[model samples]
Target: MGTFRIEGGAPLKGEITPQGAKNEALQVLCTVLLTPEKVTITNIPDIIDVNKLIALLSNLGVKVQKLGHGAYSFQADEVNLSYIESEAFKKEGAALRGSIMIVGPLLARFGKGYIPKPGGDKIGRRRLDTHFEGFINLGAKFRYNEEDHFYGVEAERLKGTYMLLDEASVTGTANIVMAAVLAEGKTTIYNAACEPYLQQLCNMLNSMGAKITGVGSNLLEIEGVDSLGGCEHRILPDMIEIGSWIGLAAMTQSEITIKNVSWDNLGVIPSTFRKLGITLERRGDDIYIPAHTEGYEIQSYIDGSILTIADAPWPGFTPDLLSIVLVVATQARGSVLIHQKMFESRLFFTDRLIDMGAQIILCDPHRANVIGLGFKSKLRGILMSSPDIRAGISLLIAALSAKGVSIIQNGDQIDRGYERIDERLKAIGAKITRID
Candidate 1:
């Protein structure tokens, strides 16, 4: 557990570049196990979750080298398969949800993969049924140990088949696609997640000699290959972080510029913020958010009904950004309803904002109604604890815009997703200190 001491009520200004997509990094790093050649990846974020995954790979005997800042090379030619069954591996794998992804590539290349029950943010019930079911559909034998909370999948050689995923889960889709890439025949996946991160994974696999089509659609077609060769891949900028910055700037009346956001890939995010009446200018690939000196105003629907923002699959507003959006709405000039359809318990963090003097109604575990203070009544800072990664960052943004000193416990939750968050915010004129 770590603490963040923040002195609030000050606006931030400067250019901050978003790190490589955290979601994309996790998926791509696991794909290195699909080939024996050197795979070089650039723009990798230096965060706790990603570093933990890298360390887990190293422990499994993958040759990992740091070429430079945010760049690494990996070779899985000498992987120690037996090491995965050890106690150390079990402990390590149990700590990260991303560890589940490694199973797909490992099963594809080695004909077997095992992992301890994975753990991650405790936002809601995230089941592994999608991943295991996808494997079972592709000719793999699945087994689980209830006593030990371990999962294993094995097959002599996977044969491709069509699968309509129960849900368009990003990780589940990535895992299934990785396994299907080396299957014996063509694999078609319907209702797949088509997020930019998943698209990047498919493009990277294609570069590595895997035949995949429908790069940006829910339906994907993959032709199995006998073997995969190494290739270089670069991750896109973190869109979630960019959205957070946009929220931070509006809430605190800050003039901040987010550089190289890869605008086309940020589907519906910028426009979604604009619905809250925050002004964002497109300066090339960068997003320039001028200080909301007059305070932003939320837009109502055409019928003069209250605005509603909900999460859905790709091209829809991401569930991850709903926390930030809800927090930002607290300072806007009007009211909005945030619907976190993808996950429950994500809206539960509004209690922390309510304690900070923001007017928020926690309608349920999945919905929140926020009445904007419009900067007339400044939020008073208070002691709070971060519940999860997205909620942690949302609380940090709220604290930055509040009045007086604030203490946030479990700052490590934020660090798992954002890289050197305090350092980056400090550079942008924020008063935040980390106590370990």
Candidate 2:
């Protein structure tokens, strides 16, 4: 029930410190259930999703204490297993994709797990098959009603084995990994999503005395231990938000410095943006976007014509941030095709961009060709509804660069990942007003 009115045509300038990774922080926070000791976490993003997860954990009898800004200590020293079947637990479980992760640790440590239908970005059919299959391979009996959509898994001591996931679903991979950590033997996960988030999860597991190697790759080896101890782990920086901020800086011709970026982990992200001729500078762990950057040409061939930006699995461009990049691409000098292979409906929001006077070709559900009419074209803002998190942030970026004041309803969508986005943009001299 909130809206953001962004006046167009100002590139964000100033300093922004990216928050902890939303994806990784959630996974690590949930891992507290694996042990009965306090797990301290730093660099946690104070976003809505993280807050919701913390609430879920608290409701399940985990002690979450805020130590400082972006720092917290969680102790599930004695999780109340009976609350797992409570209505409040089911409602909270249905509130997030990451909530499903609780099942693995619960099943491993408490002998059973219960979860209701989960909720997240309604992009497409996100399945938990891979997660359940891993549990089943380790000897789990699960029964769920399709009509009521409740799930319960009664798992014995999970004995690790090789798991070839049907798809490299991010949450699915994390769930299985969490389950396998306290299993009886070795768990080999193939086609695993070893993105920086996943890597952080593995690191946290290692800190808890779990044996996990081959982090940051498609394959991972996890050697289960009898039990795990508490550990302190720092969540990685939010690269997706960093990338969004980078795109915002470039599109608005603003000079901004983004701090605490994990430069090494951002493999291929810089180059992927470089394809559009955006100049990216790395000063230690900070990323700076120089002002008045000449936007690049989305080149096609060696002759330097129009090209496209697409998403694939990791090592390829991330599908989640493609929407933000596509919006930024609209202000570039040339055209680029954006093929969003993972989701069918992500490109549908581009119609709002077209309404702003940007030239875009919507070729079916999965693809779009965006021709930047140049910044001089003057995109005039309009009233819009935010669709999802990334796409919602993309629309906010567009509104920021457009010619008039634009109102973005459903601004809370952007609040899911980016922390204090309005305050952050305001600090950078952006004309954004949040109204409820």
Candidate 3:
């Protein structure tokens, strides 16, 4: 674990470029296993989870090459199938939740895939049943080993069919798409996750000679192909990071411009922040946030009642950005209720904010009521530990806006998602230093 020593009460100003999307990178990286040819991916975020996936790919005998910064070429001409059963793989694969994605491409190409229980943020019960059930629907035999805590799927050959998913899981949809692209017949998936990440994956697969339609909708149709070739893919900017920067600017009264944010793909994110009374200007593909000297106010509903922001499926406010929204509301002019419907434990970090003098009521494991201080009360910084990736960045934003220095431990969790976060924040005039 590492720590961040942050000097607070400074306003940050300058332009910061958002890194490649971490969630998208995980799905795209796994697709490299679907082809034996060279798959070149650009704009790859040099974060811990992504690098770990790449390392795992190398260990599995994929020909890996680092072309340059944020660019890599992978050729899975000869994968060492036996390594999937090794103790090293079991340990390494369990370290990342994204590792489950590899099972799809591996099963598509090699007729078998195995993974240990994956690990990620302890937000809620993220069941793997959707993924395995999708596989089984595509004619794969799914099995789980209770003694070893391992899940395996195999089939001599897959035959595609229609499946209406129980839930529109992003990873589950990506996994099923990867498998169906190489199956014997056509596959129709309704209620699929149509986020930009999945759209990019489908586009990349199309370039590799896979037949897929309905790129940006819930219903996807994929026709199985004999084999797939390689193609170059450039991931979109991280929308979560862009939203974080917007919240950070409002929290610390900073003027910052987030560059190349792919405005079209950011569904409802900018508007959701605007509902919190945060002003943002879209300059071409970038977002400009001016310093809020008078501070921001939460907008009331049409009924003149307290506003309640909740997470929903695609096109709704993402559950990931709810944490940033909660943190920013601490200094707003009015009260708002944050409902994190997807994750139960994500709101537990609000207790730390309460210790810093913000008024927050934890209604339950999934909801919190925030009473904004309206800049009348300045927060006093204190020591805290980061619990997860999004919470860590939210705390960093709070610390930068506080009255004194604060020490944040377990910053390693933050590095799992953001790329060189401290260095990037430093470039924007934030007094944050990473301590080993």
Candidate 4:
């Protein structure tokens, strides 16, 4: 297990650029399997999860070439479908949550797809029923191996149909959309996840000759195409990372400028941060966060009620940043309730922050009430292990603003999402070291 040794209480300065969206990269990379031609993806974040998926694609016989930093070209003209049934693939696919997505594209292009029970952050029960159920709805036969926890989907040719998703699952929507693009008829997905990442997948598919309408909305209409061609796609900056940087700047009282943030795509993120009384300026395409010398105050409702920030579907605040918000609120002037409605165990990380002297109540599995210390009491560092990606970064941010040194075990969790995080923070004057 790798570790991060951080010396706290130094305000970071200089400019930082957000990495390409990790979620978007996962979805788009799988799309390479949909076509036999070369699909070049730029702005790919150099992260663990994305790299693992890329490696999985290569193992499956996708011709992958490194164009340069943050860029890769992939061609799946000679994919080895037999590899999906191998023990090696089962082990590899089981390690990554994103691997579940490959099944859709494979089942669409080939006659079948199989995956082991995919693994990822143990935040809660992230069911794969949505993805397989969508495939079943589109005329694919689904099978599950009870002993090995493996899943398989097979069909001669998928026929498109209407599907109203049980939940607006991002990965599920992306998976189903990929399959539907090569189906026999029109596929209409209602109550779909309309996250910018999903929208990017739809748009990318459209560029490759798939007729997809309702680019940025929940209801998506897909007119199946006989074949899809190659297209070069650039991923948007990761909003979750951008939000983390914003929280880090405020918590450390730093003046940091986040460059090329794709302002329009960052729905409700900025305003949501502003609600915590953090001052962030929009300088052209960049976000400039000034030092909060006097500390920030949490905003109240119009009726002067306690502010409650909750996660919802797209256009609402993202659940990924709720951990960052909870950490940032630890030092704010007032109290706020962070309702992580999406995942149950995400709020459990608050116990680590509370150990650092932050006043936080883990109200339940789903919610946490944080009473800001207003910087009156400085957080002291302690040895802690990162539970998940988002919580790991949140803890790192807390460690940065704390007094003395903090050791973070299982640092790979943070590295899975954030690209070169310690090196990036070091460039901005943060005293962070990676102890591998």
Candidate 5:
């Protein structure tokens, strides 16, 4: 196991050029399976999750080449989709929940797709029912045997139709979009997750000849094509990273410039955080965080001013980053009620904050009311192990801003999505060292 030992209360400075989005890189890499022609992806982050997806693709017989830094070329003359039942497949596939994403493309193109199970954050009861529902609606037959916990999908030809997803699951929406791109007719996906990742997927698919409209909205209109071709695409900067850095700068009272942030992709995140009394300045492609802003009070409703942060479907605050918001609120001067409606187990980590001397009330499984004691000035650094990717980074931000020293174990969780995290923080003057 690896750990991050950080001497806290060091203000982070300098500029950090954000890496390409890891979530987008997964879908773009998997899209190579949809065509025999080579597809080139630029600005891909060298992260753990992206590496695992590349390993999965290579196992399936895609020729993956690294063309020097952050660039790669992938071509699948013939994909060995049959070998997915091997022990190696199960071990690696279980390591990343994003492995579930390949199921739809495999089934649509090869008529059968097998996966033991998808692994990801244990935040809550994430439903694959929406994914299965989309495929079932597209005429794919599914069989699940609890003995092996493997899911098998086979279809002669996927006939596209209207699909009303049970929830706006991020990957669920992505899985169906991949399956529908080559189906027989138009696929009308209602209640879809139109996150920036999905938009990137759609843009890549469109460049590859799949006709898709409504790129950033909830309702997606995907018109099936006979097959897709190859095109070059660059993944966007990570929005979750943007959120994490914002929290980091505010908590440490650092003046940092985050470069190349896709301002348009942020949608409502800026406004959502502004409600928390965080100020940001947009200078070209960068967002600058000023130093030494006192904890501004959160704005409340018309009737009463009780601060609240809620995560909803896309165009709303992302549920994936509500943990970041919760962590940031711990140092603010006011109180905030964070509602994580989609996942039941996501809020369980509030106890860890309580351990770190944060005044948080876990109202329920999905809600936590945090009353910031106005920069408590004394966080007794403790040994804490990371639980998941986003939560792990949140803890790192918390650790970096604390008064004393902290040791964070299971650093691989943070490595899963973030690239060069320790080095990047160090470049910004954070006193962090990675140890094994």
Candidate 6:
């Protein structure tokens, strides 16, 4: 365990580049399993979850060579299929939720895939039914070992067909797409997740000779290729991190220029913050947020009802940013309801904000009503523990904006996603120190 000692009230200013998308990195790294040739990927975030996946790939006998900073070439010419049955594989595979994605590509290329009970942040129930169902739909036989809590899928040869997913699950869609890329016939996936991550995966697959259409739409069509080859891919900047910086700037009244945010793919994230009265300017590929001295005021609906901010699937406001939004709302001028529709426990971290003297009403497990103090009441920092990746950053933002020193334990959770967060924030003039 580690702790971050943050001295609040210092305005952070300067430019910081966003790390590569963690979600996208997971999908792209897993796609390397589909091809025997060298796949060179750049802009890979140096985070714990991503590193774990890379280690898992290396353990499975994929040749991994680090080329430079945030770049690697992976060649899976001789994958050790038997490693999946080893106890070490079970231990490594269960370390992160992204490990489950290895199943699809492995099954597609090697005819078999297995996953131990995966572990990740305990936010809510993240079911794997969508992934398994999609695989089964493509003619894979699925089985579960109740005693070991393991999942296995096998098929002689995958014959692609049509599958309408129950929801646009991001990883589920990625898994199915990777599996379908090398299947026998044409595969049509309706209600697929069209997040920039998936689109990048499709583009990378296309570069590797997989025939895929509908790159940025919910419905995707894939004509299975006999094989895939090496391709170079660069991941987009993490939009969730960009949104967090927006919230951090608002809360601390900082002038921050977030570089290369891929503004077109950010969807409603910018406008969603604008609803909370946070002003931002897009400079080509970057987003610049000036220090909010006039104080942010929540914007009500046209009919004059209180504003409600909730999360949805892609092209909608991401659930990951809701925590940052909730923390930012603490310093806003008016009250707003934050409904976290995706994860039930995500809103529970507001209790720590409430303890820090923010006016927050925990409506339930899934909703929070934040009454913005508008800087009239300043938050006094205290010792806190991080809950998850997103909430950990939210707490760090709160600590930075508070009136006193705050110590946050469980800093590993934050490092799992954000790459050297304290170092980056310090570069932008934040008063943060990491202690092991």
TM-scores for the candidates: 0.99, 0.97, 0.99, 0.99, 0.97, 0.99
Instruction: Write candidate 2's Cα lDDT for 1-436 as tens digits.
Output: 7799888887667898898899888888889999998899999998888899899899889998999999999999878888888878878889887789899889888889889989877777677888888888877898897976888889768888997988888888888898989889898999998778888888888989899999988999988899999999988888898899888887888899999899988878888887777788999999888875555566567886567678877777889889988998888888888898988887889889898888889998988888886676878899999988899999998888889899999887889878999998899999999999
Candidate 6: which pairs clash? Answer: none
Q: Deviation in angstroms for 189 in model 3?
A: 0.5
lDDT of 3 by residue, 268-366 (tens): 999999999999999999999999999999999999999999998897888999999999999999999999998899999998999999999999999
Q: What's the CA error at residue 316 for candidate 6, in Å?
A: 0.6
**Candidate 5 clash total?**
1
Q: Which stretches of candidate 5 lie over 4 Å from their true place?
A: none
Assess each prediction's global lDDT (C-alpha) against the native.
0.96, 0.86, 0.95, 0.96, 0.86, 0.95
Model 6: lDDT to the true structure: 0.95
- Full candidate order by lDDT, most accurate first: 4, 1, 3, 6, 5, 2
Q: How well is each residue in 1-436 modelled by candidate 1, as lDDT tens digits?
A: 9899999999899999999999999999999999999999999999999999999999999999999999999999999999889999999999998999999999999999999999889999899999999999999999998998989999999999999999999999999999999999999999999999999999999999999999899999999999999999999999999999999999999999999999999999999999999999999999999988999999999999999999999989899999999999999988999999878878888888999999998888888899999999999889999999999999999999999999999999999999999999999999999999
RMSD, candidate 3, Å: 0.6
- Please, what are the lDDT tens digits per residue for candidate 6 over residues 1-436? 9899999999889999999999999999999999999999999999999999999999999999999999999999999999999999988888899999999999999999999989999899899999999999999999999998899999989999999999899999999999999999999999999998899999999999999999999999999999999999999999999999999999999999999999999999999999999999989999999999888999999999999999999888999999999999999999999999988888888889999999999999999999999999899999999999999999999999999999999999999999999899999999999999
Q: Which regions of candidate 2 fall more than 4 Å away from where they truly are?
A: 303-305
Candidate 2 lDDT at 7 equals 88
- Model 5: clashing residue pairs? 97-119
TM-score of 6: 0.99
The residue pairs found clashing in candidate 4 are: none
Overall local distance difference test of candidate 1:
0.96
Off by over 4 Å in 4: none
